[model samples]
Target chain A: MFYREAGEFKTSYVDDNQTFPIRFDRYRYYFVLFAAFLVIPFAVNDYWVNAVFMPFLIYSIAAIGLNILVGYCGQVSLGTGGFMAVGAYACYKLMTAMPEVNIFFHVLMAGGITAMVGMAFGLPSLRIKGFYLAVATLAAQFFLVWLFNKVPWFYNYSASGQISAPERTVFGIAVTGANTSAWASYMFCLVFVFICGILARNLTRGTQGRKWMAIRDMDIAAEIIGVDPLKSKLSAFAVSSFFIGVSGALFFSVYLGAVEVGEAFGITKSFLVLFMVIIGGLGSIFGSFAGAAFLVLLPVLLKNVLVGMLGWPTDLAAHLEFMIVGAMIIIFLIAEPHGLAQLWRVAKEKLRLWPFPH
Target chain B: MSNEEGYVTADGRKIGGTLMEMKNITLRFGGVKAITDISFDIKEGEIRAIIGPNGAGKSSMLNVISGFYVPQEGEVWFKGAKRPQMRPYQVAQQGIARTFQNIALFEGMSVLDNVMTGRLNYMKSNILHQAMWKGKAEKEEVENREAVEKIIDFLEIQSIRKTPVARLPYGLKKRVELARALAAEPMLLLLDEPMAGMNVEEKEDMSRFILDVNDEFGTTIALIEHDMGVVMDLSDRVVVMDYGKKIGDGTPDEVRSNQDVIDAYLGVSHD
Candidate 1:
């Protein structure tokens, strides 16, 4: 009953075009944001922060990036892992080269660098599309990982192939490195997540989003009606890679603390993020979060339930988790191809009409 | 209707001079010629129709006008400027908008969003501004929304503003396509078989919208249609094509009286 928009009227176009036009949705979103920023960090400890929240937030960023390309702009890409590696490597290079610069700027710049890389890779998209484009990006994935692994300069000519994050602080509070507190790192990633979420939502609802969607839904019609395919596709790539890069930077410096490129951002990483986008719902920012949350929590939940509570072997539980994820992907594809975001929308839609069926 | 003073409709709306001219536009696909030496000029503030039997290259002519298929040899003149070889989008940027023969609505978006897409060329804020969604981008978005809302209102699709284009009926989809083209606020609007699958009432509504668009906005319109009644009633002038050649081009009555036009329409044995 509380979800209804019965008497709540929008007075202007500005009001109508809000990300959450309904008063209830707007307030609920504010409450979620409040909990995420003000409440969650206080209650959560290291285990929850490191194991659950960080991966969810970081993967949500990557998924949002992928969704913009594959979902919004209809460009299927398999190079997410490679692009993320670019971000990670770029961040690594910048962190070592300029020890004095803020980590925030480094992360943003890493994203910028990845955007250029993404645009360059996106050049082939203008000529090839669909499966061919996916295969092209798959090449990007393999090539990027291989490049990072083979290039010693990327690792600062270290004896080992691993590149580790040095101690970094913001306002005297350590957000990265071995000495960092759980809450500081959590808050840092949380801030990026919040900002990125807002930026993505804003971009998708405006002109850029329209152009991308127009290109996605019907490229010929879009081009004929004045959307430049090159701009839209490349912009999608640039924007998507920017987010992916940011996530990758955070993935390395803040989340992982050290990375061997092949082990960390492998092909599976690409598929994992793709799974999040597919299971979450393509083309939806909220879906990115939903997919990330579901996938992130699944393994944890399975470990506790299947291994801890049920006394199953660890290997068996891991195998079962894989099976469950595979089954979930299949079920989601067959049943609700739009993913959890669409389910949430339908649920909310029904809630709006609760207690009375038309 | 035409004189030394320039053409005027019976309703006394003055049709202006040539807005777009096609000079010897010959489009070929491989060894086959689609359009051969077809020349036509569309006057400003008038509805021009291209009509022919199946395989007469009518759609091909529309494609040439919209820049989907660049002619092998010809020049397109727009408002007295000789248009160079350009992509379809560049042509759209040059104040031309069109609907496809098969309703090409962006099926994934709401009616409002699909129509808003037509406002893309006018939306100038960069991605940075768009991401922030405050100040410049917000102001531009709101202003363009105002313009789009007007087109939505004009087309009377206010009720289904937020409905996805895929969910709408075929008739409404055609109207949505028109609304999208209109959202561009082009100097010239092209409609490809707008009433192809419409019922009697829907066709009348579309015809009225076409007339009102011309009367109110003074938009130059070029259309391809199979419905002879629609062609004769809605168009100020008609171009009849047969076998990739312009058989007749004149006022509807003049074309109706042409003997060659009769043979093309009624079919005559050539073999």
Candidate 2:
């Protein structure tokens, strides 16, 4: 009943070109949003929202961002962690320098600054491509994290080599740092994720999205077909950076409260995000969300179910989680390169017919 | 504005309005020369073919015209003005479009979306409009679909509109690529070896589509073809290249008669 489209007629051509053809899909999206905003907070306790769900939402946003550049645009980048660091650092700087500025604006500005940095790294993509270009982005990750750590100004001349969020609020609700409540933080991040998800969807669905995909599909043919690789590739970097930067800002300010430069947004973090996108689906917008959610929730759920409940050692549980994730990536690549998004689609298809799947 | 923009030439031969002109292009890749002082003109509303053996830089020529590879020497003039050193998108903005030799249809995309991407230049709405799926973006999508549908009809690819490009046959994929190119409504159309890998029936179908595109749209076509018969039949004039140099230029019959072209095709042995 949750996915039934009995009578929805598409009268106009505009209606026919929708991302979702069925009316059930539209309502389902609305229902999910409703549950996320309303039902989710009440259903789970504060610890669950803060420790698990909030971080997952935030990671999804960053995964979606990296996916735009790496997946959709066909640009290989290992600097997502660096860009995320830029976001977090930028937010810190903005909040300190302009105390009166809205936390929302500061978060957005962080993303904007990250976009500029992402573009700078993306310049090398024009000269180099494939694995060679990927190596160039790895340089971005190393150099940026190193620079941020050394630069005292980025950390506000903190005595310790770590930056922590200050008191930040939105509409009288604590939304950042240690003082923030679990529900408020989750809601804030969830809202940001919602807006950014919609933004990513729009961007990838339009001329910009088509341009990136065309380049990803085939650069030479893309050129003949009138796609400017320079503009498209850079735009991918900019938009992707914006999402990641914002996510990083949230990861520190809302979720983590405090983060050391090398610790939080390191190369491992970059790989984690990349893995999320890869396992979700390459060259798919929805795949970014599916991947982020699957990867984020799986380990936590696994550790809890396998270790916490079954009384296994934490090390063994962690190892099992890693192996499962690794094996799934390989299987997905060989069996269904589209990842969990494809799985979700298949599930939806079966749901459409219910008893009669033939 | 293009180099030939608003210019008129009342010549004895047919002045179909110079849509695109590659002026004395000299392209070199380090030690090897790709195109050596080659010059060609495409008249508006004419089907001009570039014929050459392998390694004659036929693809290189198309690349230069499409702004993929910049020529070392010479200017590309379009519609009566000196064209800027434009990107591929800029070239498209100047009302030029192209198809690839290997059927460059976006493999994972549906035939409809692949063709729709050709109208990317014309889709005016911004990200905000697209996000809301609101007024301008919706209207633009509708307009784009209408235009693409016309191209689909022209290519007779009605059934495979929703089918992914990867699943389509080689002939259908090539036609879809053409459909995608034609969707742009380009003033200058470039097709690189459109019938190179096609069977006899597929070649005939592609030829018919090409003729219809030129006739119906008044599009100026500059094609590189291997099949001599298709080149002779479809094109008004042929520019033959040998060793990156223009060996013969004129009507197909004239190029066919030229002894240099004959020698280039059938290697001339020194006495």
Candidate 3:
């Protein structure tokens, strides 16, 4: 009864085209934002911040990026890890080379650099698609990792071959490095996530989104109907990589603080982000967030319930986690390929028609 | 046809000089010739039909006009200019829009979004503006939506505007495709078998829409159709092709009376 939109009349096109057309949805979105920004920082401790909130916020950004490329644009990419490395390294280089600049600009700059690199790798997509495009992006992933590993300049000639974030601040509040308070860092990543989410949602609802969807649905028909494939595909790459890059920057500088190219941002990391997009839902922005949250919480939930409570071996829990996630992917692909986002949509749809089964 | 003044039809609709001319066009696919030295002109504000049996290259000629296939030998003149070799999108941006024989709607999108895609070239706001969803991008989007809504209303598909194209019936899908093309506000509209698999009522509806579009918007239409009666009733002029060659080009009566056109349609006994 509360979810119904029976009397909500949209007299104008702009009203009808809103991100949340329903009055209830708009309020719900606002409530969620208020909780994320105003309530959560005051409540959570370091363990909760680092373990659950940090990874969820950061991976949400990465999932949004990959979804734009694969879900919206229909260009399969297996190089999210490599592209994220570009962002992390670029942020590292920016942080070290310009010590006085704020950490916020550093993250934005890193994303810009990653976007350029992402566009370069995205060129092959015009000539190839599907599994072939995935393979091409995989090459990008390996090549980026190797470049970061082999190049001494990237790690600043450190003997350990690891890059660490130097302490940085915005408005005299420490947002990075060892001395940062839990709330401070969480707020920093939270702000980025909020901005990125709004930007992504806005972009997807407009003309740019339509062109990308057109290209995805049918390239030949899209071209014939006046969408330039090159522009649409490359822009998807640029925007997606930009988000992935920002997430990577935050991941390295704020979240991890110290990362080895091989260990932290590797092939597995790429697959993890792709899994979030797939299991969340394709072609839906809310799906990206849902997928990220689901995957991030799954491991933690499995570890606590299976190992901590049941007294199972840690390694067994890890293996079981793998099997469960694998089985989930298969089931989702077979039953609800659109993922949790679609499931959520169906639930909302049903709720709207409740009290009667029409 | 050469008169500079341009004459009005018996129905009081004005028809102008040729809008597009295909001169000696030849298209080949490595030992296979699809269209061979065929020539035709589509005049302004008239419904033109290209009719042929299966594999007679009617679709190939349409492809050539839409810039999908570059003819090896021909000059395409549009509005008195020798058209350059343009990508299909560039051709579309030059005010040419078309529907496919097989419904080529973006099945994943809603009817409104599919129709909105036709206005992509017209929606000129940059990525930044769109990302912000404020100022220019939002304004341009509203403006385009207004235009698209007009087309949707004109085609009487208001109820299914939010429905995904994949879920629509074949008849509605065809109508949606026409709505999309019309949303482009194209100077020249190309339709490939618009009434291909429609029932009698559907065909009648489609024919009325086509005639209404031509009369109201004054859109110049070029269509390839198989149903002879529908083609004769709808088109002002008909071009008959047989095995990669133009057999007849004239008014419906002129084409229907041609011996070669009759032989192509009724079959000839060669002894």
Candidate 4:
């Protein structure tokens, strides 16, 4: 009864096209945002922040980016790790080069740099598609990793070839480096995630998002109806990389504190983000968060239950984690191709049609 | 059929000058000739039709006109300017919109969203404005939405506006495709088999909508169809083709009386 839209007549186009048109949905969204922004930081400790919240928040951004390119634009990319590495290294370089600038600016500028690199890789997409495009992005992944590793310039000629985030503060509170508190880093990442989430949501619901979907659904017809493939595709790549880059910057600088390009931003990182998009739901913003949270929490929950509670071996828990993830991905693909989002939609539809079985 | 003759249709609309002209177009695919030395012009305010049997290259002619296939020898003239070699999107931007023969609606998108995509060329807000969705972007979006809603109402697709195109019936999907094409508000509309697979009732509804679109909006139309009755009743002029070559070009009655068209239709041995 509470979920009905019976009398909520939209008087204008702006009112009709809102991100959450339902009153219940809008309130729930605001409640979630409030809890994330206000309640979580005050109540949570380091363990909760490090093990669950930070990774979930950071990876959600990456998932949204990949979903835009892979799900909405229909460009399969396996080089997300490489692009993330670009972001990390770019953030590192910018932090070191511009010590006086704001750390937030450094994070955004890192995203911008990764966008250019991402677009460079996205050029092959116009000429290739499907599995071929995936391979092309894989090439980008390998090439980017190798370039970052072999080139000492990216690492500032360090002996270990690892780029580390120096102490950076926002509003005089350290948000990066080993000296920072967990809450400070959490708030920092949370703010960026909030902005990125809103921006991604709005972009996907608007004309730009429709253009990407049009190209994804039917390129030839999209072209005949006036969607420029080059512009639409490259814009997807650019915007997707921007978010991935920001997430990477946060992952390395704020979350990880230090990273070697090979081990941290490896090919497996790309697969992890791809799995998040696939298992969460393709072409949905909420699916990105759902998938990221599910993946992040599953590993932790497994470790806690299997290793901590049941006294199982750590190695066995890790192995079991892989098996569970693999099985879930296959099941999600075969059973409900739209992943968690479709399930959510079905549940909502049933709720709306309550007491009437049709 | 002189080029200068301005014929008035029964609805009292004057068929204006040439909207789109194709001269001596020749399209070849490797060793196969899809269209050879074909010429046709769509008047500014008339419904033109191309009728032929299977493999007559009617689709190929439309493709050539829409810039999907580049002809080896021909000039495409639109509104008095010689059209340059361009992409399909460029042609669309030049005020030419078309529906596909296979109903190429974006199956993943809602009917409303699919129609809204046709306004992409019209909505020019930059990325920043769109992402922020304030001022110019919001205003342009509302403006476009109003226009798209008008087209939806015109097509009588309001009930299924929120439904995905994939979930729609075949006839509704075709109507949705028409809605998408009409949303572009093009000067010249190309319909590739608008009634390819439909019942008689659906065909009648589609014909009425097409005629209404032409009469109300004054849009010039060029459609490729196989239904003889619907084609003859709807189109002001008919271009008859067989085996990649034009056999007759005139009003429906003239083409119907032509010996070559009758022979082509009756499967008479041309050799």
Provide the lowest-lDDT 10-residue window in model 4 chain A: A349-358
lDDT (Cα, tens digit) per residue for candidate 4, span B4-66 = 566787656789888888999999999999898999888898999999999999999999889
Q: RMSDs, each prediction?
A: 1.3, 3.8, 1.2, 1.3
TM-score of 3: 0.98
Model 3 lDDT tens row, A173-215: 9988999999999999999999999999888889999999999
Name the candidate, 2 or 3, with the larger TM-score value. 3
Candidate 2's DockQ: 0.54
* Tens-place lDDT digits, model 1, residues A1-358: 8688999899988899888888889899999999999999899999999899999999999999999999999999999999999999999999999989999999999999999999999999999999999999999999999999898999999899999999998998988899998989999999999989999999999999999999999999999989999999999999999999999999999999999999999999999999999999988999999999989998898789998899999999999898997887798789999899999999998999887968
TM-score of chain A in every predicted structure: 0.98, 0.94, 0.98, 0.98
* Candidate 2 lDDT tens digits, A1-358: 4456567777877677677888878877889989999998778777798667887899999999999998899999999899999999999999989988889999999999999999999999999998999899999999999999998999989899899999988998878866777788888888899899888887787777888888988887787666778878998999999999999999988888888999999999999999899889887778988888888787788888988899999888889989987787787779877788888878887888786557
Tell me, per candidate, how large a share of the native contacts it keeps: 0.92, 0.61, 0.86, 0.90
**DockQ of every candidate structure:** 0.91, 0.54, 0.89, 0.90
Clash pairs for candidate 1: none
Model 1 scores a TM of 0.98
lDDT of 3 by residue, B1-271 (tens): 4354456665677889889999999999999999999988888998999999899999999999999999999999998899999999999999999999999999889999999999987998999999999889999999999999999999999999999999999999999999999999999999999999999999999999999999899999999999999999888889999999999997788899999999999999999
Model 1 regions lying over 4 Å from their true place: B1-5, B269-271
Docking class of 3: high
